[model samples]
Target chain A: MARLGRVLLLLTTCLGLLGTAGCGDDYDGLVIGVVLPMTGPQATYGEESWNGLQLAEADLRQAGTNIKFKLVLKDEKSTPQEAQTQAKTLMELEGAHVLLGSVASSNTKTIAGAAKENGTPCITPASTNDNLTTGNPWLSRICYKDSVQGGVLATFALSNGWKRAAVCVDNESDYSRGFADNFKGAFEAAGGTTHFEYFKAGNADYSNVIQGVADANPDVIFISGYYEDGGPMIKQAKARWEGKPVIGGDGLDSAEFLTLIGDAQNPIYFSTHFAPDAPDEPAVKAFAERYRERFGKEPGAMAALGYDVLFVLMDAAKRCANPKSAAELNTAIGATKNVKGITGLISLDNPDRTPNKPLVIVKVEGGAKKFHSTIKP
Target chain B: MLADVLLDGLGLGAIYAFIALGYTMVYGIIKLINFAHGEFFMVGAFVGYFALRDLGVDEVDLPQPLPILLAFLVAITLAATAAALLAVLTERLAYRPVRRAGRIAALLTAVGVSFFLQNLAVQVWGAGARAYPEPGIWLYVDDLPAKADADYKIRERVEAVVLKGDAIDTARKAALRAEGIERVYRTPDLTKEGKQGFVLLALLLWTPVLWWLVKRTRMGRAMRAVSEDADAARLMGININLIVAATFFLGAFVAGVGGVAYCATYGSVKPLTGWIPGLKAFIAAVIGGIGSIPGAIVGGLLLGVAEFAIPALLEQLGWADAKAFQDALAYVFLIIVLLVKPTGLLGKPQREKV
Candidate 1:
């Protein structure tokens, strides 16, 4: 019996070795790990971005690129812990050369950490929190940071002569707090007074906070929260503070927000990554048309950014001497400059690996998103 | 401004009261902390959503004010019945099996049921917030000179204006027409006072019914007897099972009503809708002395008012940023109440028979 057990253990060890070797086999292509919230609360954003990624992949193949690409998609389930686990699995198990994805900033932070630990290049299509890319070199995002949008809105508010602003910040969310802080700083610096009201995310009632804002009686109400809370808050606020131009960050970029407010005549404005209607650029128009045809739904900022993330990754890969090597891809991605993206001109030459891009300010008019203006950062 | 804050707080208080009543009553009778109680509130909200939006409650054509009033009544009845049935079902299947096992076992089972229902809701309805259809009611046109062109639209708009309790002059109507708006109706909108008024009215109507049920009815006496001592009450020829189910029915009924009020006030519902408010209501029950009926009401109102009012009061005191600690303040209130009155304000001291 002992002799048979030893033989069986030896056989199992040999099988494990062969499996490991097979996984480590080299492929002459870029293996991009795509982690996204294919389920859970942020599924809409994930599904749209995933569609965009697929379209980009097909387009790249049709356009005929020198470097071969292999994409592996994993569901992060709209959570930070899940995102981290999936990113690690994609890198260690699937032999991915680079990582992409995770729409939410909190989830992207975990992916960024995983990428840094594994010495792999990671880029996000949507996560806009400034701190995610501030110190991480391995991490790069196609979308502009929160500070840019905040500053742009503040400047825009100032230009509009909206002096007094009520900045409603969701204290539970890092994105909301950071965005509100940045806006408050920029707005106050330019001699505009801001009244701050705080709320937690996932709250159904904002009556107290709305009453506070109404009492403050600000010219513009800047909601620094996700659309889930922002929509209801704006609806409640409009009941009291009528005609107040409620401005928000890209967190309010969801079709559900328009539906939530339901055709109210409160001139709502939010700064987002892309506006398909404005500027009428041929590339953007074509991308929008293709997206509508493919998904049979209007493409939002996430879809546009997701489409750009791949092209930017490919652009960097084509420049690299060894496109499959993680280190080479990382270096090449950091050296990206002036790549024409559907959102805007993308560049990642900065040490922080953040691209300087223009943000589109869209307004909720007639229960639809209308392009108000674009702010160059 | 203070009135606005109070009214909003009262509106919130009504919701808390509905949920807290469930917790208090269940704990009062069974000594099982029904953690799944909140999920019933959530289920009721979803039921209300479906009833109003998909079930054709809004499609019933009636006279002015009759449609919306009928809609509210039908929706409330549907929600209450659904919640009551669910409560009874959970008790029969989950809680009853674990009843004699111990308090901890039953409590854990309650929690298990909560997770099950919440996940089930997610599966049934995707984990996204669905917009609650606006509940608007029309009123009779008091005295506006009706326009010949689009007279029905003008009357509808005038009815809406009248329901808002605002006398719109000819110039205002002309401005509205020029803006290309045809029909308007009264909703939680068109008022400085929030949805609290409607919620408060519901509470005022329901609390007395609840009071009469618990205090004045024959079943109320039997429930009180069973709560006092289930074995002794059973020996005395009271149907212990029937009383227990009735208690659950009453508690869940109010929770259902609260759900309707919640959606009507908040304008949206999701799978996880009941969790937070349920937690808050649980805290309210604890503060009010969990097993006491009056305790639940007082506790809920106090908690809700304090939650909204304290932040406003702090802002008045120039602590403009105190809203960040709004949720924290609720826990602190709970802790302080527990510390000062260990048995709660209205709870009787427990006596062990030697």
Candidate 2:
């Protein structure tokens, strides 16, 4: 009877210790929601961004900070409706305090509205549309807006003494339209004459419109379309208008364009958030090397923006005394300024959450991109 | 504006006509719409790309005319051979046992085959799009002169006092430089005009070949007989299996040609490259009266032209946002044509007697 009593006491003691261990450590883990296009046409962007976020999470853990992060990943599926649905689910169902998300501008806009309705703080990693966070106080971005990119590309053209410019924009897409408009605005402001032509998205033939532009004798042509149409457009335009410089926004950043042009003599220039040849900070170089090591290829603007957004969010989280509450997190994020990122110094200047970051210009030479200049706003 | 729109439409229409022939031919014989037909086109393009690249044909440094000709010939033969083998295998494995089964079963199999081919392609070739090397020489521009010279005269008063030599060297130099630049500018390595001429030549050559196969030879008679009445023709010693296989081979060969031509025009290939064009071509075949070979050609061309023209026309009529509506134009035309003439433009209505 005495031995049985001792055995029961030891079992109770062990059970009590196990219960305490299951309850976790001293700090309550932080849960941040990530909504992105995990599947679909933009899945590549989502996958790369997720990789950057994972790297940041690892870095934070290695820093020996008491704060532990729990990431809740949701798929946006690259559609506005799906983005809004995912945002709502993340905030309401998942009970996430802060959200990071949405590669495409349209998707970002939709999710931003949802975040605003729920009073949840959301940071978009790669969306460059000018209007997403302009008036919305709850949304933030780590990349430059279309206005900045467009202005920079236009200024570059004018600085190169391009007097007459022709703009070919993707009419069906808001990103193309906004970028083209800002470019035109900046170009005309710099004393350059602009003629605008619009092509519908997925329209394969640009021969007629391009030929018309050639006849008009434009000194430069600005194309605001994704790499799909951009590649073919450059090839067709080069065929018709020899030696004309074709300029574009971040949409033309892909290596696929070089493949499409295939030794064409025309020089193609584009404005993007980051480039491999740009002045590399230690953090940027580390990220680039790590990215190449992991992916067996160079990272693009989306990857850099993704890596920066995570650091920005982490910095905001560190500032808040009560990081668990959504309201407190939003207030903390709104106060972010001059965070040194892989892309550049990111400052959330407007509490309204507009992206006012810097832009980089890159030119395609010899089947690869060479960094030209950086434009600061 | 209409003229420009029509011209643009016609150019695109020509491309669709080529792809549509592949779909119509197979469907006309087998009554099975091969969903994986589009991927054959993709395969052809990649094969052409590798063949040219292996031959060391760079974008800036092209091979001699004979080598290029040999490369294209070899590439086309390989594409046609691969497509034929694939078609036969697809039929034997996926469709043969289920030949007499319901239409739904065949369709389901086709969809399954399409997914299988797509996934296989993705596994073999990475998901990223591959760029095809552009041909280096401009066949049309070789006849043009490399440079041009301009002459300027200087007056000489020989009797009065002095004779002056002409100083037209500077003017001639300037003219030559300008002409040189113009010549360089005018020559594009990948000439769409040249490709179009090649497509026209192929069509002209193949028409007679197809006509002889279908109307003159024993194989053609057997194919026609089998297509008209399979059971009766089988009893009449037509050799149904052989005829069916031959038809598939011929259809796949044509499809391979179409695929190569499409890739040559686009200069880029992707795993999903075939889906849109294939769907459009299938719709073209349906619009042209599903079982008629010539109807498929006419329908495909019309559909391509219509797709291009509608949006351009709409944009000219002050609907500047008409481009967004371009994708829907094909279905709209299909619906209108199907409603107006069930037998199609060139299709004959079959009569049945009980």
Candidate 3:
């Protein structure tokens, strides 16, 4: 185990070197430094986000673009405070012209301030808080807002003729709380009765809530938490609910979720930014195929968005004459519109840089999540 | 709803009581808190998991009651043995040298050992919580597995093929959209009860067995004698060191049982699985009177009932929004105990001559 960890550390160091150093003498002078939670509670998201960038780099090289930018990666340790500290190091110490990522909405909020203060363009791949980009023009996100996510879920549930619903939300996280609150409002507004239970991340017991929800006996159970908490909760629920559908947001989208649930036959649905089963264009299909070949697993929504963030940044850079200037890069990022991505067409024309995109319902089939349907926003 | 909540609390409290046994027993024999007791619980859990899921029987091949019973026995025995050995090692290596180096030194070492073990588990398993095999009852129907190994294999194969599919997924998506959401109405509230009853029964069974060991066994007598006065007991040819080691072993054995029961109830295990639960159990031990076995059990049940039932009751009172505070409730109780009865519920007030 120690040896594996050492190897992983070595691999990370190598990847970091490859990202920051010019591959050859002809490499461009642009520097895009990324800060992500690579080693803490949110490590999986960071690893996936990094893979997305690698895949994006390969795609850019294949396109034969003359523009070359070195990448510098920093670990945020999955906390807003760490993100705040790391973002400064990336901008000042690493001489980063542009910044992207550091997942969770709270961390993105911190990065947002750093970008504004540093005058460097920062694009987040998957921070969904509605307030993330409210006043920070230097920041943008590839994913949809948490507010819209919950409403979309309510629409999906009501559309399916399921009137009664019971829910669980991870109140410790703003992302989970945002979606759960929004879903409750939307569901009730549409005249569906609902019951709500609450939990937090890092907690293992949900028996009390499970029993309470089981008694409520709704048509479906909505879990507004990440895969870590959602996975076991579903298993416990399945033992009682007897095949009831479990719905969640993009937070529930992880390969580990399947590992925890372990062959549960019950229907599990989650709303996500991207679906490998259905793509908006042929490029998406190609990207998915290449990602599978490279990583030995299908790319998740975060990876897809991470890939899109790169293109979005590149598109912004292509339009800029003075690409090396951080201020110029910031301006170019703000003007981004209709850049093609494997997830969808990237357009940051909205004032807060919110993307006008589609959301899909992914159903857990066998052990993998497959597209159930798409909702146009 | 109240009854269900109570059952849940009782079940959790039962786990706490078992873990608390280790804390209380060790403290009783030697005046140490054994901060690494929680890690011992975690270690025991992992050991049981390996024995049952990785060694004793395959999840698919197990034929109902027989395999489950066998697996449970194996899990119990293996976990207890590992925990006892771990306790002995920790005492010899980390505690023995610091035994006369002041209480604070031993306490610091205990904390360090706890952290070391947690990080070690994280390195071995990664940070993700691995799924524990489902309880035997969940799979059994008339003493036989409800699903065959072939069914499990096929499902795995189907998942693999679908995940790898670029062409097949497109075809499946078209079909999925048509039958998308199956319409169902509200289920009967009373129709489902959580599996806490099983935990209650399992825990209740351990009470008498532990009572027999403590009251009627030779080791238990030595343990009591040492607790009274180690120096005096040693002077009488009681082999004080052996008695202390035996106490640690017995305590850890109870902790091992606790670690196994906990994950079996929760459905998953992680490197830090026992951290919070073990902490709460220690609090339970304190409230029951830190060095008292009966105190630990009583304290554990009380803490469990409060943890589970408080949230349920609060939710009913329109304060369901207070879920985050439930974790803090145990600490609150701890503070209250310190203020009201420092000696604990079953503990006698200590008299210091100084």
Candidate 4:
């Protein structure tokens, strides 16, 4: 009986120790996890975002903030399955207090789902799909949603007196369809006519689609595809329909797009997040200058958004009572108002955590994207 | 509109034919469908891309047609050589040992090899699409209806000088260069049609050469013998391995040429570039009667024309989502062909022993 009592005591003691070990109270400082497509087709955006984050890190260090934190980055490889796995690792293994990432909406959706399940705050740098933050309290974006940009483009087109428009969309991308559909709806509601053409991503030929658009004889063309197809399509379209103005949403903003269009001076315009040369935004200009100095390449909307996203996260963390607690940080982020960002004056005080940011229009001329105008949202 | 679509189809068909030839040739010698053949095409394209972008092929200071010709020649040759080597290596390492294995095993091995090559490419060259160096030859389309007066004046200044049928002296060319017109537009024969014709002519010329090689040469006879009965050929002291390797070499060399044609026309190359075209070419090969060379050519042209033309027809018929169904329609065509003629267009039915 005495030996049995001693064994029960040992068993209870071990169970108590294991339970305490499993509790794993949050880390001493804050852990911010970054998931991006560092490789695969979307690597260009991933690389730019990474460069922006590096600049953000530099900014933090230079400012000499006393916040104890670490930033961990993982490559999603442009696959949603990989993104989920990485997000899980970031949350459970690294004990991330916050999550930032994923350029495209499809992958971002997967990451956000994982973040919600883990009760971690997730901020996407450039994903602009309308339904991302619909019911997910933990999800938010630094950039404007698809509806805003789509509506803005429609207004811009109407203001320019382009009544008839042809919108080309990538059939494979939900982002493309969402943005194009929104634009089409808004444009038609505004008493404009729209013709739709479809193309798949990774297709090298756009001549057939370009011909179809030319046959429609619209005053303007809207390419709702990424830079990969958009650039070549614009090049071909300019050859076929010389004078028709081509416009697109933020998907067309990339360095590769410029290279693909290569010296074609046709009137091409795209809506983007931030414009370095927009004279009024001194913050944008300074950020662009620093990005160029740091990376030696022109910073696109994505890079600027990446920089802004990190700062926004840091700002929210600063407001948090317990910065290491994800719930606290998330609440703090939702309360963000008038955070001066490179993109614009960001405020996420509304129901959905999307910033009411200004959209900038850029023109492709003389082999570079020049800032043309900014539309207030 | 039909003519334009057909020309575009023909250009696309030429690329399919180049890849289809490889599929047909490899299946002819050894009944294994070489799924990795597409990667061979991709490898060739990357080699060509590197040659143009990094090897200073574009920096060569040759005049007019010479530099253009030199660039194409160098890129194609390097691409072909690399593709051929990779094919031979693939056959020796992956296919050779699996030859005696059942057909399913060999097929599964081919798929494995395909995945290996794709991931290898992704590892080495990255998954991003790289812009191909445009040879700076503007395609001249004379049939494009003349624009309004204001736009026509600007077009005239930048239009190709070759349209006048007058020889461009070096000094006048220099003057045009100073005006930045020569850079925008130059050389009538180097137009898009000209490039397509060049690629098609090269591809078409090879059919006769391939026929002459297989029908007349000793190596050709040996390949036929091995195809008839590998055991018999081995017993007759013929080196079946050498013949199979040579067949892979020949097929991959052609696929490399196809790679160059594709990238040159498309102006970009990525690791996944080969996947769809490869699958389509394989379908073309099947449609042409998988083992027959001439059948691949015919099937490729037919499939290419149908793929482009049907969507165009649908578009004209007011089907807005016609292009969305483009890929689906290609498979539908494949299914229809299979149902109509199970043996394919030119395939001879084999006698089955009960």
DockQ of candidate 1 is: 0.23
Query: Better model by lDDT, 2 or 3?
Result: 3
User: How should the candidates be ordered by TM-score, best one leading?
Assistant: 4, 1, 3, 2
Q: Candidate 3 - CAPRI tier?
A: acceptable
Q: After superposition, which runs of candidate 3 have C-alpha atoms over 4 Å from their true positions? A: A1-29, A61-68, A262-265, A279-281, B29-35, B56-64, B83-109, B135-249, B314-325, B328-338
What DockQ score does model 2 reach against the true complex? 0.12
Residue-by-residue lDDT tens digits, candidate 2, B1-354: 566555555556666666676777667666778787777766666676677556543223343465456556777777777777777766766677667887788888788777667656765774445666543332222333334221111111111111123332445445535554222211134465566557656765765687688789998788777777778898998777777777777777777777666666656666666777878888888888876767777787788778768776776789755655566766887889988987777777866824
Per-residue C-alpha lDDT of model 3 across residues B115-218, encoded as one tens digit per residue? 77776776576666777754332221222122222221221234221221133233444443354412111111111123355556766887788778777898
What lDDT does candidate 3 reach at residue A37? 80
lDDT of 4 by residue, A1-377 (tens): 43554475478679856742422245677888899998777887898998998899899889987688777888898999999998998888778888998898999999999999989999999999999999999998889999999999999999999999998988789899999999998999999999988888876777677887888899999999888888777655555776788899888888778767643546889999987788867777888899999889899888998898988988988897788787888999999998988888888888989998879999887556799998986
For each of the candidates, the C-alpha root-mean-square deviation to the true structure, in angstroms, is: 7.3, 12.3, 7.7, 9.4
* 10 residues in a row with least lDDT, candidate 2 chain B: B154-163
Q: Which of the two, 1 or 3, has more DockQ?
A: 3
State the displacement of the C-alpha of residue B339, model 4, in Å, after optimal TM-score superposition: 1.2
Which residue pairs in candidate 1 collide?
none
How well does candidate 1 match the true structure, expressed as C-alpha RMSD?
7.3
Name the candidate that leads on TM-score.
Answer: 4
